[model samples]
Target: MENAQAVAPKSANSKQNSARRHRFWKQFFTYLYMVILAIIVMYPVLITFITAFKDANVQAFVLDFGGKWTLVNFKNLFTQTLYGSWYLNTMIISVSCMVIQVIVVTLAGYVYSRYRFAGKKFSLMFFIIIQMVPTMAALTAYYVLANMLNALDHYWFLTAIYIGGGIPQNTWLMKGYFDNVPYDLDESAKLDGAGNFKIFWSIVLPLVKPMIAVQALWAFMSPVQDYLMAKFLLTSESHYTVAVGLQTFINNAQNQQVVLFSAGAILVAFPIAALFFYLQRFFVSGLLAGGSKG
Candidate 1:
């Protein structure tokens, strides 16, 4: 009986020690994995930042920790290139696309959620089907159409293309989010003598602001990061977007401005990163809620 009592305490102590060691290892590995991933992701950004500030005499491709930092790369970026014009053009397109897309998608989503019309179900299914087709598949058609219309190098024409491509999926996402909102609110507003537009503007719109922010962010980013479409559409240096303009710096062996390219790349991230941080609170909620039903 005494032996059994003593053995019980020993077994419990051993089990407790083993569990503590297991938990310690689990936590240690989890932190190690996170640290490894952080380093991997941050390495390129760190290199770019360092390269952007290095002296003009230093080779841009060569990684050197010891160097004089200078602002000549940025100075050359604006003075030597058409970066100002490209930045303006890109900003115009992005803002125009964001506003127009938000209005169109919000209205379309509302209609699909609240109203029954001819071919409504078929239209919804059609959108889903068409969204499955990758944008690359239609590049040839876009190019031919642009050529035929003489819309090449037109910023508004490029904006229209972006807005058209975005509508189907964005509308679907918006509609799913709208579906989550109770119809009772709409009915109550109607009963209180509110018109359709009033209820939408005053009631439903506020509730779906998160999804709108998400949609706006998506719309804004489309032109900012696009390389292939912008390259194909805009040919004139005067009308180029930042993405296309930045590419010119290293497009050929003769015109390699690697440090300048790094500087431009760093500046390009500011607007996007600022907008993202501002809307980040809404981002996750909007995506999750919009996707919940659909």
Candidate 2:
């Protein structure tokens, strides 16, 4: 009888251990599935990075896992292209747009959140409806309007487009975030003799720093990545952004020089990737905070 009791308890413990092992394997498979998905997403980026370092012979043919490495492609990128001008032009547009958009969006967000003025609902609805309209649909109007203002090929034009395009969603997003902030803070600031701008600048803006950072980073990357609008808008080669500059590389007689193209792509992707990493921690939190209300 003692042996039977001991054996029964051992059997129960073994069954429990087996169940736990089975659960662990199930979780491991789920994680493995996600890893595979991540690899699929990242494979193209890895290939492009590797291709940038490959020698001319390897670039002309299918990629081999074993290939000669060379800095010739990177050298070609610097010598053969107006990379500096493109870099400068893109930086100007991106930075200018980023600053303008952040300011405009923040102010708009604050107003929409705090005010109960007439037409408030209608104005918000209008912005929402405008957001739903595709940017391409307004291409004709934007082109004609910009031309009328003689703004085409001007660096500031891209800034205008970037800020205007981003405003509706950003306004709503920031406004929603502001709504969740305690109104008592605003009251206390006012009682302490803080002006409207002071309260907004000091108290409110500091609290919404995460969302602002995310928006600015996003704004900075837009014109840098945009090929279509920038292509159509900017007629001068010197005025071309990085996206257009990369296209120019392929458009010229050296169409088959894939390594040079790869090098340029890598350069173009670097800054945006850095910006993404810099703001990555705040991005999701900002959006979630913006969306949630008290």
- State which candidate has the highest TM-score: 1
Q: Judge candidate 1 at residue 256 and give its lDDT.
A: 79
Candidate 2 deviant stretches above 4 angstroms? 1-14, 17-21, 60-65, 146-150, 250-254, 292-294
lDDT of 2 at 148: 92
Flag clash pairs in model 1.
none
Clashes of each: 0, 0
Tell me the lDDT of candidate 2: 0.83
Best by lDDT: 1
Cα lDDT of candidate 1 equals 0.88
Give a tens-digit lDDT track for model 2, residues 228-273: 8898788888898988978876676645666777788898888678
Question: What local distance difference test score does each model get?
Answer: 0.88, 0.83
Residue 218 miss distance in model 2 (angstroms): 1.4
What TM-score do all the candidates reach, one by one? 0.93, 0.85
